[model samples]
Target chain A: MSSFPPFTRLAASLPDHVPFVGPEAIERERGTSFAARIGANESGFGPSPRVIEAMQASAGDMWKYCDPENYDLRSAIADQLGLDVEMVVVGEGVDGLLNLAVRMFAEPGEAVVTSLGAYPTFNFHVTGFGAKLVTVPYRDYREDLVALAEAANANNARIVYLANPDNPMGTWCEADAVEKFLAEINPHTLVILDEAYCELAPASAIPAIAPLRPNIIRMRSFSKAYGLAGIRCGYAFGPAELIRPFERVRTHYGVNRMAQVAALAAFADQAYLSEVVGLVAAGRERITQIAEENGLKALPSATNFVAVDCGADGVFAQKVLDNLIAQGIFVRKPVARGLDKFIRVSVGLDHELDLLAEALPKALATARI
Target chain B: MSSFPPFTRLAASLPDHVPFVGPEAIERERGTSFAARIGANESGFGPSPRVIEAMQASAGDMWKYCDPENYDLRSAIADQLGLDVEMVVVGEGVDGLLNLAVRMFAEPGEAVVTSLGAYPTFNFHVTGFGAKLVTVPYRDYREDLVALAEAANANNARIVYLANPDNPMGTWCEADAVEKFLAEINPHTLVILDEAYCELAPASAIPAIAPLRPNIIRMRSFSKAYGLAGIRCGYAFGPAELIRPFERVRTHYGVNRMAQVAALAAFADQAYLSEVVGLVAAGRERITQIAEENGLKALPSATNFVAVDCGADGVFAQKVLDNLIAQGIFVRKPVARGLDKFIRVSVGLDHELDLLAEALPKALATARI
Candidate 1:
């Protein structure tokens, strides 16, 4: 145990495991680029032309530091949400906000609750802060909110994480159910409602942005339907007191100037966002159709991606995913026990879906063999 | 105490004081933008044309999430520094990296040593992580290496932060003095060697890249000399063992995609960097000359900023700063006791510098009255 340059006990306990293996890393490993990159749930529909223009226009302003207050961006987001500006705080992304939220609420060795296969990034933050993770298994491939509420109470967890219109599964709960789940959790247990995929979800799936709760921080991102994943901007809104503490802990200039400019541009283009959503809905249907054509069942999705049941087990789904990668159509699958039979694929361009459609049967055949 | 939705004891103890109020916030309060944004020590020279071109070229690719590995950018930095890729880790900025470093090394209630009023952002992080900050006052205008080393040893500090070509003062120690300071610190204490302004410093001021010490993590940034502050990209390099822990705690996709592209292009365009460095040097001389004309003494700077002493107290210096802001020339002053008499001005464009020169005498007169 060489303790030279000693790390904190928590840091030493952490394994050097990255939460997500980026597609670029996979491409490097393969010594070639993926022909259709649909692995990471990023919007394959690029940002609005206006966002690209805004980014290009602001390219020369990179010498200036970001406005640490994030006034304009927060004001826009708050105005849209029908909330006061003080209720909102912007961060690098939903991932970045989660890191701050966990640090604020979860003390070392205290429990934090989430679904078994919810966002690994949240779990990463919780563990990074030395908090114990208490997981509740999904029910019918959806986050079992009731079970999560129960687990938080059972463990006296400091934080509860739930991603609506969830990732890796593409299933969702309606506003009423979420509201009930919110009411069931203890006020001491802070709830992080990560709505990263909210734009792609049906309106019924999202709660009205009113009656702000003291314990709940609702997160939103431009990375999904707005098609600016690379910009890494997101915001969390809650009670004013809850939002104020973030100022005490956050990296003041963490949100880059480009992100502020691009997100503002993206937020203003509601027409472009709606257009992307429609396209994403259409892409989701095409993916479902592709799954049916390959004699597999695609789960219903309110997200930009569809989860197709590969009709076997975790091993089979992994084999199918690997074969898709082998064929240069990057795809991923759930790793949780009950949900592992599904392969998740994002809605890409028509040509990319064509690549997926062309490669799926071959991938399935190889998995069968 | 109204502890519902509890924050950690450490978080609750922190004041909502932002480390540095951004120039934009000041402008907002004044209900107008600054004529010359020379504060924050950001390069007003702007990023290279090639970097801007790279950003514009990659605008449409904002739909794709950044490569979490930061592979290509890390490889480029490692190659230039004559170090292994594993030794280098790209972060959102040096600010973001400092957050990680403090978290990794300093446990709650443990001492972390640095000079008083060195970099408030580092102090912000130290307190944010619940670490006990033990400060040694600056000797003269420079960061007193002897006092810092003594404090680290006496306190058994977990980490010691030193910025060569120190911020707010622009004073630096030679490589030999720094090497001696490094040798004096205990092996168990981590040293965050921030060389953010290293590109502007003379060659003799920077220590050699090789013979990497186990206890030191050297930080460098594109935010300063490369003029990419808005992009929020920087890297830290050290022994592989120390660098590996960052992956365990960092926001993997925090550095936006445009940052990666722009920083790579910026790093590749060395001619533009040298040109900017030359321009900055000339600007420093002009600022010094202006100080002389105004009958003020400007500190010799190894960075892009010069600190002009007001020859009075902090109150008089602050009044001069306020008057300069009133005239629409943004600048800052060190808030530490000994350093507070001086106002820090960054090297801006010729036109911006003209504004500073035009305003300085008026500002001094106002302060005197």
Candidate 2:
């Protein structure tokens, strides 16, 4: 390799491979487009019409930079959540916020805890920052709050991550269990409660905003239920003092102007959010039914996606996912050993789901071969 | 102060103040809006009609996550620059790209070089990364390139930053001088040439990209003459080896979907860009005239904004800025010592300039008090 300016020892050590390969890359590789865009856990139901109108109306005003403080959006979010404005901070998305959170809390070589098969972006950040990861294995396909708390305390970790209504497995812990987990974890360990899928999840799976604690930061997003993933907007709410430190390291103008408008409109359109939540619920049911008809066991999901156990092991699930892709359906599976028996599929439009339903049986048969 | 989570020692030591406060903040604080939104060096003329139409048309598709590879946008940028796609990396803006650059090159306590009174966000990143920043003051209102190179060499700096057609001062060094600086700088140092205002600059001010080098990253933005600041899109091109590391740390989906669409359309509509450049040149002339009309000396500008010397010191220039803001004409000034004698005003719509013209005399008179 040609010699160049030296990267930080931490940065130099990180692997080049990203946590997720986007569907677009797969499409380019296959040299054909997938008829069903049912991967990446994005809502195909799309944003509310009001949000679309808001974005369209403001499209011409792209000459101005976004409000660095995100004042208006933060106020609106605080008002909706009944929290102080100082407690809310918005960023490019939950992904951006996670990067900041890790940079803030976890020093290089310090321990950071998360479930083994949780959201990989968090792990990517931890590794990027040179933090030692202490991964607790998932218990019964749900994030085991008890094991995570123990690992965090035992390792003296600086940050502990838990994604409720989690990705890949689409399983969630109840609100009471979450509250107990918050109470039990080491207070010095910042628990990043990634509730990106909160709006799509059952109300019982979400904790109340009242009696907020310093150790936990609750992340919410427009990407899931509001269906504004492409706009790249998410917010994290916690105690005021904790939230203040994000300003130290965040890219001040990272959130674009259109995202602010789209998110504000989406937040205001609760009627549309409710309707999408209903749609996601129905879609999940349909996906589960499809999995059953194809002789696979779909895990009970509190998210917009379902993880269907492929009746074999990691190789079998991978083969099934590959065959689905080959059949013009974009779907994914967990890569970690214990969770690899499952293939995760996101809810899409009805026609897309119909395409999935048509493709599943043939894909399974091919995978068996 | 109450103690919560333990931030990294570097993060904890950094200040909480943001680099720039948005004008909306002033609007909120004063309970009034500025009639002229020309403070932040944003293009009041806005993005092209085609870009707007593209963004508006894609408003409903906010449900899909952005292509993490940024393939199409990077390809577009690379083709325009006569470079391979591997040499290009798209980001949220130059601000976001700057952060990545700092993270990639500067380890804690390592040295970085830049002109004092240049872009504060770059300095913010340097500090955030725990890098030792060695500042070289501008000479004759332009970045002292010789001094910057010397400082980088003396300190064995990991990075050297120079913004051609620079911010705040609206000044630039010629292409030959820049090329000389590039040649003289230590090979181990990564030079970041921020050419954000290159489009509005005289053609001779920007160096040709034909002679590509490993140690330099040329940062460009859609935020300047392209008039898409609000979309928060920018790209950096450099040797592929240098560019590849950015993927290791960048928030893959950090650039939103709307930004990609707007920027692609903006890049394609070069005719609109040419028109905007002409308008910016005309606006710069008009602003210079306005400054002269008010008995202030305006620096000749190659960028969209002019730095008008208030014929006084830093305090007097601040007074002019305050009075303009008080009169609901949003304008800003340099906070650095030598350059702080001038108040920077961005080119705006005709009526906004008229409003600035109306406010300048009274503000100057009140400051004389």
Task: Provide the fnat value for model 1, as a fraction from 0 to 1.
Answer: 0.88
**Model 1 CA deviation exceeding 4 Å by range:** none
Q: For residues B1-369, what per-residue lDDT tens digits would candidate 2 score against the true structure?
A: 356677788887988777668988889999988899988999999999999899999998889999998999999999989999999999989999999999989988999999999999999999999999999999999999999999999999999999998887999999999999999998989999999999999999999998798799999999998999999999999999999889999999999988998899999999999999999989998999998998888998888899999998999889988998999999888899899999999999999999999999999999999
Best by lDDT: 1
How would the docking of model 1 be graded?
high
lDDT of each: 0.93, 0.91
List ranges where model 2 is wrong by over 4 Å. Answer: none
Q: How close is candidate 1 to the true structure, as a TM-score?
A: 0.99
Per-residue lDDT of candidate 2, residues A1-369 (tens digit): 346777888888889778768999999999998899998899998999999999999998778899999988999999999999999999989999999999988989999999998899899999989999999888888888999999999999999999998887999989999999899988888999999999888899999999889788999898988898899999999999889888888888889999999999999999999999999999999999999998889999988899999999999889989999999999988988799999999999999999999999988899888
Best by DockQ: 2
Show the colliding residue pairs in model 2: none
